[model samples]
Target: MQGHGYGQPVKQPPHTAWLVLLRVLFVAIGLFSIGFLAWAMMLRLAAVTRRSLDWGLFIAVLAADILSIALLSMEPGDEIRTTSGNFAMFLLLGTLVATIAYYLAADIRHFMQREQAYAAQRTAQAAYAYRGPASPHTPPPMPHTPVPRTPPATPPPQRPAPTHIEQVRAELDELSDYLRKHDGRHDSHESGR
Candidate 1:
């Protein structure tokens, strides 16, 4: 095996001709599908828009498809094997080609216009988004810093200020203690006597 660019052997298809044929077959299918889709789309557009020219073209193409199919399927000595039949086939095919071309062109134009509109809309939006300063006179406001949400440090609970009545009660209790001490000393003196 011959080494490729990266020191790897080039892998080849088992049947290159068969693969090529398959690709051609798929391409043909895709093209036919696209052609049919265009035909359908033109018919719908003609109906919705009520355009006489589009309707005529749509009918012509439909007739072309039917006639072509019939002609190709018939045996050589059939009734449609005459000069008139050949002329009809040619006219139908030409009409089909012209109709396909017209619709394709119209579709392309529609898409291009849509793309341009979208681009213009995007540009307008971008212009709005990147607006200049409202006024070149004043400075811009400072960016706000978010305060951290830590729990507040609670202060120790404080005693309320003493009331007048409570202060008087405290003084009276001190005086009673002093009088008790002095009266005990006097009682001791009397016992000695």
Candidate 2:
């Protein structure tokens, strides 16, 4: 009666196969993107007579693609026969969107960090400027000193002392007497019934 009617623990559907397929697809797409980007870089470099292919960006994109693919591929079940296929598709699509969003977010974060650093640098420069040279300079004439004022004294307020053990015991006894009287009345009424 404590167990389920099925007599066995329900098994979670396998999704491993679907994850593998999604990962493969993601990697394929990523490789394609990299190739395209490289080609684009080459064209740009050729046109300007300078290396414009940002290796850093290429590496970053590749790393992101790899990590995304890995995460998607680790999911469990056969993509062709199970619900995993649909899940794989959804995850792939989501990964693509997330990748783009992450890229934009990363760019924005980088820009903000750079801007903050620049502002901090400028602030430091301003502070240093205000400090001026360390060499000794002519000091200004001393101003007249004002007399110090004395503070008014006030008497301290008195506080009651803490209750001693005897006082506490007396209070506890009073409470006990009150409770016993109430209990006695309750018992007498119950017995009469």
User: Pick by TM-score: which candidate is best?
Assistant: 1
lDDT of 1 by residue, 1-193 (tens): 2322222222332354654464345334325653333346457547644668778877766666666656645636655676656765565556545655676565444444444455544543444354344333443343333332444488545877653333544566677779999999999999999
Candidate 2 off by > 4 Å: 1-82, 130-193
lDDT of 2 by residue, 1-193 (tens): 1322222232332254653464355445534664222223222223322323334444544454455456546656434444554454455455455454444344334344444455544543444344332222332233333322333266544865532322444565677789999999999999999
Cα error, residue 54 of model 1, in Å, equals 4.3
Candidate 1 residue spans exceeding 4 A from truth: 1-56, 67-80, 135-193
RMSD of each: 31.4, 30.1
Whole-model lDDT per candidate: 0.53, 0.44
How far residue 30's Cα lies from its native spot in candidate 1, in Å, is 10
Provide the global lDDT of candidate 1 against the true structure.
0.53
